[model samples]
Target: MSRTIPFHFVDVFAVAPLTGNSLAVVDGGGELALELMQNIAREFNQSETTFVLPATRPDADWKLRSFTPKGVEVFGAGGHNTLGAWWWLAAAGRLELGDGPTRFHQQIGDLVYPLAIWQSQGKLEKIIMRQEAPVAGRQLSNLGALATALGLNAEEIAADVVPCQVVSTGAAHLLVPIRDRQAVDRISPDAKQLFDLLNEVGGEGCYVFSLDPLQPGTTAYARFFNPTVGISEDPATGTAAGPLAAHLVAHGLAQPGVIKVEQGTTLGRTSIIEVGVDAGSVSVSGRGIVVASGAFSI
Candidate 1:
């Protein structure tokens, strides 16, 4: 007989509900098959969905797996999904108030995440993780063909910075720095052209960014497109935000510390993502609110 498993859906990186990236979480995923997990992730239709499995090591906290809607297993860490999973575990009473730090053994490697829970004015709040510093990769291409793929004119591209470069902390993305926020908002890339350019750049996807240093801590504005990976436009992307922060510091565009990223504005869903970079590794963290909780039979 099939048994229904409990799950929780959350909006990450938002202080309130409905403002950040959404993720679905299955709390106990020790026995689910990889194919079944992929199918469930596809049915959820989110940019990323997570399954919490049993940890082999007695000292380890949990074993987590992340999957995209396209059924591809993700390497490295995900910001919103991590936060969403923590929120679910804490709310369900599986984790205590002073659980200290939690270790997640992911596809990339083992990640240690510290938990912080506070009660202020009778409202409960939690911040589960800090991301590692970003790792910079080689510059790949210029703005010529990339501009064509992104539906932008050559003149509209940024000359000071090159386009179609690879950047990563744990996951790699082709970084495409645009000229302005307006150009970023108007982007509608041709799928075939985008796929070809991504292959040429040796990246799985592309991240489009523009400087929006007007905000006190915010250094840039960005939107990620990965039609090749089954996501047209990501509302808030934590994986991309890590490398974007590194790019800003490496290029001297922003200070080498904590920075804020604003995304999904053009898509009508605004999200604020925070990134902390120390030395070389980067850590991306944010708030997540539980939107719904239920169960499904496999």
Candidate 2:
């Protein structure tokens, strides 16, 4: 005899059902073994898959564990995977939400984080998640090697505007400033070389961005790559966007308010990530829609 587990495919940070970053949300995954979870993640083959589990600690309302297609366990409460899972839970009526803003605690790894959602007339509005305090580390100085890794000329890097450095809200990713949107679009990275560079810089992924955004009122046009975790390119990465917003503010490149980041244009799944940085703390918020839901047999 076999059993099936319910799952949902959500488009996080999306304007429509199919846009933004796709995530697989698995319900009642706490009973499954670790190896089985990895196999399920590989089977889905998305950038990330999230498992919603019952909370072991009293302080948390629920527990979330996200894994990459490569079986790498992602440990960030502010990631799209976590947000999409919560969205699915709320939309599926798995959790009871109030009419206004309701708060919930999510246990990711060893720490618990707070998340809020707004509801009006029994409809879910938006989800906001607070990330860890911003931390800066490991500035890269070798522009020529970095350029080679990204398949661009050394002169294309806008080092005068902001230094290429690692920033983290929860997951540390290297933030590189580019000359323009065209240059950002033209990047053809060598994955192996880029992964090596990221390893050297103590970074998990690379976020290349330009000040000139294609969309008005957007702070930056960006692209994300995390070869270490087998994500060739992500449509929208909240973990990276939060850090980029803080990095810009720390370097005096942008104001410390609501920073909108436009990404995934090159992939055709355009996404907008709203990040707010105030007094060295960061928060990321977005909305997601359920495009597909089914069951996984075991």
Candidate 3:
């Protein structure tokens, strides 16, 4: 006989429904096998699917296992992945949220990330994650070659902006600043070359952005491509967003405050990822709206 398990469909980094990065949250999976988890994640074929099990550690409330569509288990504190699970839990009453600061520890593959979720009148006000200090990684000095790989000419490369560089909070993402919105939108990088280049630089993917944003008050409008990890373009990449925010602050492009980021426009799913940076760690926060929920039998 097949067992039925509860699952939730979530849209992270979007205020409205049906617009944001997608996450499939599987509830009550303490007994599920790793191979089964990979199959389930592949079945969902979302950017990432999470299996939430009872916490083994006393400090953690829940243990999360993240899997990409490539059928590989990922080890890290995924920003939207973590928030989306809790969002559904709070919405479904699995987690009791009081009108105060609630500290929760999320265990992912033996790694724990401290998260603070604020609630007001039983509504989630903010979700903040304390990430590791930003680490400056390999820098790409070849602007012309980079521009060509990103489907742009050398002339379109923004000379006034900072050079292409890699930054990591949890994951390393190459940050490339373009001249304007038009240039950013015009980017259609060669998939094979981008994947190879990112691998060459020890980066998971590349985040190409433009300071001139379509939305007001946004620090930048960006797009993340990671064909190497099986993600063509991410709607809202919280992991990379943190590094990007840190890069901006370190390079004197943005102040150490709440910086807004708009992403996923090209895919029709507009995502807003808020990043907070100060003298230490970076906090990436966003709202995850429950789009659908049901049970899966396997």
Number of the top-ranking candidate, with TM-score as the measure: 2
| Model 1 Cα shift for residue 67 (angstroms) | 1.2
Greater lDDT among 2 and 3 belongs to: 2
2 or 3, which is superior by TM-score?
2
How much is 44 displaced in model 1, in angstroms? 1.2
Give the Cα lDDT of each candidate: 0.74, 0.94, 0.85
> What lDDT tens digits, residue by residue, belong to model 2 across residues 111-136?
89999988999999999999999999
Question: Using lDDT as the measure, which candidate wins?
Answer: 2
* Prediction-by-prediction clash tally: 9, 0, 0
Which run of 10 residues does model 3 get worst, by summed lDDT? 72-81
TM-score of 3: 0.96
What is candidate 1's lDDT per residue for 1-298, written digit by digit as tens? 9888888888887746887788899877778888989999998999989998776555557667888998987656656666677667666766645444434433223554443544344344655355555656656555778788899987676746644468877677888787888898888999888888777766767888888533355778888888777888888888788888888777777776678898877776778888877677577767778889899987
Q: Count backbone clashes in candidate 1.
A: 9
